[model samples]
Target: MGTNRWKKYKIEMLPIKEPTEIEELSLENLVDQILNAKKLDPNADTTALEREIDQMVYQLYELTPEEIKIIEG
Candidate 1:
């Protein structure tokens, strides 16, 4: 019963594949790519991503939430 419980609790590990192509870009380039892709894509996910980006940008730029709300309004 103990052995059976141990077997049942054992985790199966799967092989993980590393990505073949990974390109590292500057933060500016990354932001540009994200914004451009968001502009091109008209999906709900894209809009949500854009909103997240906007919040990050505002925080990084030291803009207040009130300022953002004003601009957004």
Candidate 2:
């Protein structure tokens, strides 16, 4: 949260890219980039995408509806 390294990062953000390219990175790196993007752009919105991702993760793990509520809660 305190570092500025992400600000100087030159890679194109996946969401904003055209003819998208896959950049394999760890979850930590992905989260860092997301947080950094938020920091750099406070008005940036990704709520729908977040929910989509959550649903995908839940489906991937075959989590139950009850489990989803518990986990999301």
Candidate 3:
């Protein structure tokens, strides 16, 4: 019988910890974060998470750039 190549290595698994609280961000903040991310990586491909967030935000509020600024102020 052939010896196992990885028999000497010991693997340790860490316990997963639950979050203390669920932090919620306003639509404005989410939009700002998404815009900043896009600006930072304009050539990057669009992600499913980003698309989902965009859809959620769009459904909740259909505000223009001007309106977003007004709300932020």
Candidate 3 structure quality by residue, lDDT tens digits, 34-58: 7777899976554754665655554
Score candidate 1 by TM-score against the native: 0.40
lDDT of 2: 0.61
Which ranges of candidate 3 are over 4 A from the true structure?
A: 1-25, 45-73
- Model 2, span 26-46: residue lDDT tens: 334555766777899977786
Best-matching candidate per lDDT:
2
Residue pairs of candidate 2 with colliding backbone atoms: none
Model 1's lDDT to the true fold? 0.57
Per-model CA lDDT versus the true structure: 0.57, 0.61, 0.55
Error of 1 at 23 (Å): 16
Model 2 CA RMSD to the hidden true structure, in angstroms: 13.0
Reference-based TM-score of each model: 0.40, 0.44, 0.30
lDDT by residue (1-73, candidate 1, tens digit) is 3554445335445333332232223334556767688688845255555676566566556678789998789
Which window of 10 residues has the lowest lDDT sum in candidate 3?
A: 15-24
Best by TM-score: 2
Counted clashes in each candidate structure: 0, 0, 0
